[model samples]
Target: MSLVKVESSEGITTITMARPEKRNALTQELCDGLYDAYRAFEAGDDQVAVLQADGPAFCVGADLMAPPAAMWKAVPHVSHALTKPVIAATQGWVIGGGICLVMTCDLMVSADTTKFMYPEAKVGVFGGLMPGIVSRMPHKVAMELLLLGEEISVKRAYDVGFVNKVVPLGEERAEARRMATVIAQSAPLVIRTLRDFANQTLPRGPAEIFVPERYKLETIANSADRKEGAAAFREKRPAQFKGR
Candidate 1:
């Protein structure tokens, strides 16, 4: 099995795919490694988390050679189900399950040479998660990508608001980290609460999800960090937060 090599620095965590030989394809072992990493970041105070590919591609798709149908089930939900921020840094061909992985991330940065397509239609499989494609762009455009299974350009992805940024073919990971650093500079608690709010808000939310937001706000309000923030503002200095 390929290893999910990881590196962390300055409150930023980078999870890399060590299976470069297969273009970093997802396997059962990769899912286990990813779940472990996700659990670690969710439990800690990491400012940002990045998913990067080490090979010629971010992820080609699931390792078709892997065993157990249950493995495929666990593979699909890895991205969207994650609570913390995840940036999918794409480098090369992104196909099949790869599209779903990118869609699940909070932010996506693909290289100019990166190619995306859903070949499931031609291969006797259906489509995968398209992630607010209907809301982010015209239904016609979404349908074109879905039903036709055509590749979308990096520039086209940005215009539709799915991709956060695009960089040179080999510089995806660095660009993602640059975006993550800006996110990490903000208050941790605020970032979490806002992320939840942003995901589940108003029309389909607030109606059912208000209590959690209330709890989150109260936790922040009662935290020592909040008090320190006020104090720091009065003293004209940066707020020192201990993630309380």
Candidate 2:
């Protein structure tokens, strides 16, 4: 079964995280599913996307035992180039890498019950990509959340500019959809240009900068020419490279 569910109508695409049983954890399967969903949304006729999960919790971060091979693959902007904007509608707990995902979105609507936390310092595990949060909100506020490992209230998130809007529980999705509708009605070229400029203006962190480089290296590492070169070296023969 697919870990992600996509619904489109009237130029608005709803990309839902469907692993509610696991609190929408970022398992390898879920990450890949999200990656595919994002790519499809980028290529489809959808004018805007609302990212929400079908569960009490938006996400609890990575699965320690079976984490995604490339968590960046599921992250907006980091995973793929998207011309259309994504609005995150979150509820319950959004922790650690989950916060990383939300921070990248163009806008966010948080439920009243939503609690955003980055407990990486307490858990002794961090992917180091979250420092980019500084670009979105106040530096001191971002540092407080990242360094303290405490939960930030939805109100505080909104006040700090991390969250664009805060609505009552179960209303976040509706609010996000309304916002998406407005965006969908706007001029497409203007929207895309604004998003493109905003992305270019943001300062990328180590993880963001590394993901593309890693892809390049991995492509060469897994190429047929690489295998042939290794085999030729071991067999004491000339390599037949097809430039693949």
Candidate 3:
């Protein structure tokens, strides 16, 4: 079976990591498939996308089952890999490569039975893509995750705000689908623009993000649909946005 399987229906694309026997561990094919999936999502008309895995494990991180070159190719230039919003549904062990994937996504949802860790140090290899974790999460939390490389539960992940939801085991995919469905029902461009805004702005402190935030706010606020949205809200009606 293909390491990565992508199915699009009703304007939602689900890119699933399909290797169950190996805990869906990253392999060369899987990395290639994921990279291709990202490009496809960027080009496709699908407005919402979900990155999930099948079987007990989400991903144990990048495929150690391949040549080092293959792993590096997938690792490089994927730091800010996505321009569109991507949701990650994680379960089981989300180690080295898996942590990188979750970091790249706009949102993450894990199963209550999920496990997360970064064991690269134990293996004597460097995990460079993990910087986003430090950037997004609190300092002490990121330190705890990396220093010990211990597996963390899904509830801990959600409490730390790393994941948006934590469902029962085997329900991560369903929860992600439900979220994607809700997002798909909204305006495509508007949602995407907001995603971009949040990613670009949220990382900055109030002082740091102020200027960029103002620019984005002005850009979106000046949009015709923004006016229509405001008018609709005041009128107690649904927003009929033309995405103008």
Q: Pick the candidate with the highest TM-score.
A: 2
The Cα local distance difference test for each model comes to 0.68, 0.89, 0.73
Q: Where is the poorest 10-residue window by lDDT in model 1?
A: 202-211
Instruction: Identify the candidate with maximal lDDT.
Output: 2
Q: Which residue pairs overlap in candidate 2's backbone? A: none
Q: How do these models rank on TM-score, best leading?
A: 2, 3, 1
**Which one wins by lDDT: 1 or 3?**
3
Q: Write the residue-wise lDDT of candidate 2 on 1-244 in tens digits.
A: 7899999998999999998988888988898888898989999998899999988999999988788778877788778778899999999999888988898899999999999899888978877678888888899988898899888999999998889988999899999999999999999999999999988988888888888678778879999999999999999999999999
Selected candidate, larger lDDT, 2 vs 3: 2
What does candidate 1 score on TM? 0.73
Alpha-carbon TM-score of each model against the true structure: 0.73, 0.90, 0.77
Candidate 1 Cα lDDT to native? 0.68
Tell me the tens digit of each residue's lDDT in model 3 across 133-210.
Answer: 777688888888888888777778788888899888877888888888888898877897897777666553232224
Number of clashes recorded per candidate: 0, 0, 4
TM-score of structure candidate 3:
0.77
